[model samples]
Target: MAAVEIAPTVNPVTKAKKPSFQIEWASSSSEVKEAQRLRYKVFAEEMGANLSQNAEGLDIDEFDAYCDHLLIRDQDTLKVVGTYRVLPPHKAQEIGRLYSDAEFDLSRLDHLRPKLVELGRSCVHQDYRSGAVIMALWSGLAQYMQKNGYEIMLGCASIPMADGGHFAASLYNSLNSDQMAPTEFHAFPRLPLPLDKLNGGLEVDAPPLIKGYLKLGAKICSSPAWDPDFNTADLLTMLRLSDINPRYAKHFLGL
Candidate 1:
């Protein structure tokens, strides 16, 4: 996309242009830094995830160099309000693994590596948590996939463990067989959530991002992994391009 200003995302309900924001790929190191700064703000400062303290206040890791940064900015202020990092298959191979590989044994997904793209560190600024920002992110993602011919989207979707994981345990316990990936695609968590120790019968609603993934045909790959640093239960999520919901196909993929 060459740092191009993409088409204004339309509000599905209102059919009005969201002129307050612009979405684009990070074409420069400074642009990527902006996205990283937002990640630090959301993950470290707001959510209190145990990220290493940095002088520049950026959330960074070894994988950042191998991934492409996607940014959604406030047009008025030019602040990156929403961000997602994408690891293409080639880059993942160069990096030797997808980030999810650290948390889960993804041996079963070996056959699909050539077709997989990893999405991670997804976050929207607290003030922009309204529906539109997320939708705009999706629009940018779908366009990326459509142009690149990627087949699968993979990532770890986190569930807060504020209640010591009862909600995550219950949510995993509540999935139907159909909502789970086939056994051949199942990933085993290295540090699994202690489902047996938690109350798994609580009625819990999935976080909005997770619910949206499920609606768009993402499947749970296996049991949740307990991410101590993030203080959340991480579900390895897989979404096949072929399985995208028809309703979202048009809005996201422009099919």
Candidate 2:
């Protein structure tokens, strides 16, 4: 069978010549649609993931209506290089739940939900996956959290399971001891990854996004969940504002 040739992402971002990228909330529905299109390109076209709710090359979902869409756009090309959908507490209440609730049981986190924000559908254009672009995204997130007085953030960090889940299993086991959250905050996955059946000895570095969260003192609050549609193992990660690594917190929050 012939392999799918993924489209090359345009206009790569670099540290030396970083493009003028502006991060802001989506001001219009069109902007939100653009972010969704970028997501489809990466999560669907590039990775070959099956998106059941995807429509017209956009990763559409009910949560989108209730969430704030943050976009990082390249001023040179006027293209959206990165995006994150943030569900604030009130909006989560309006929607009656968060997107993460579908993949994992978050009942243990009810107490934190009042001051918590749920981050979902986070992605950066493949070409713009540089330190500058990602940092810009995080800087926006930090500002949003502080501006809104959010105490905690939660999201699912994904690891590709195309290797038949071995790497995901190994990565989970490797980080469990040091990065795992307390039992009181533990979540249960709806479709848990079968770790026992997979090899957990392979030494593989976590993906950059996951690693960044860990560097910021994010905790893995549950075992891996098998997301068949996305073909990845999802780890529930939580980060409290007070728990951020002091060294990097200033950089992200501009403190």
Candidate 3:
């Protein structure tokens, strides 16, 4: 696929260009490397993840070669500020499976596989954690899904386990009752979070990303998975294009 780059236009009222942020698909190996470096800084330096490729200061994995990376760059600084890596079905097939397959059993989702895309390694630079950066990333994703005829978006949205997973359990307890997907779409975790042992009653605040997913009508596909390497509990999240909130879908797709 060819790279897609979008830049904001100047506002006529102020006669000045907006603080620019552009979204694009990583077009070359170097661009992908830049995304990896950003991921490393966020995941390792900030989140304390002991990344496998720490030697290069990059959070790279085997799946990167088969994924199309969406990047949000600060046009003024010319630096990648946010990124989301996507693996379309064809590319996932080439690699034998999606990245989420490593953490969960996806056999039950076979029916949706044809129209599904795996989204992973999502992170934003600390300086650009404002809502605008995330909105830019989502806008790009909406365009990618529509352009490629994809219907289902799948990914693991993580909750930090720093508090021994009380917050993760609490978040799951709150959402599972209403947002759990249908039985056929449920996935089983290889290393499941021990919900019974955790304090699910605590009114812990959900992570901003997870909360955003809920607002967009995403479903929690199953219980949280314990990822030792990343030191987080990951919940399987899925969003069907048809189920997106009408206002958001229209705004994101410009319809």
Best by lDDT: 1
Cα-lDDT of candidate 1? 0.90
Model 2, residue 92: C-alpha shift (Å): 0.6
Report the Cα lDDT for candidate 2.
Answer: 0.87
Model 3 over residues 139-196: C-alpha lDDT tens digits? 8999999999999999999998898899899988887556888888899999999999
lDDT of 2 at 219: 96
> How would you order the candidates by lDDT, starting with the best?
1, 3, 2
- Model 1 worst lDDT window (10 residues): 2-11
lDDT of 2 by residue, 13-127 (tens): 6334433787778878998999999999999999888976544789887889998898888877889889999999999999899888989998999889999999989999999
Q: Which regions of candidate 1 are displaced past 4 Å?
A: 2-18
- Each candidate structure's TM-score, on Cα atoms with residue i matched to residue i, is 0.94, 0.90, 0.94
List CA RMSD, all candidates.
Answer: 2.6, 7.2, 2.0
Where does candidate 3 clash, by residue pair? none
Encode model 1's per-residue lDDT on 1-255: one tens digit a residue. 744354555767876663776888998899889999999999989888999988999999999999988899887888899999999999999989999999999999999999989999999999999777888888888888889999899999999888899999999999999789999999999999988899999998889999999999999998999999999999999999888999998878777
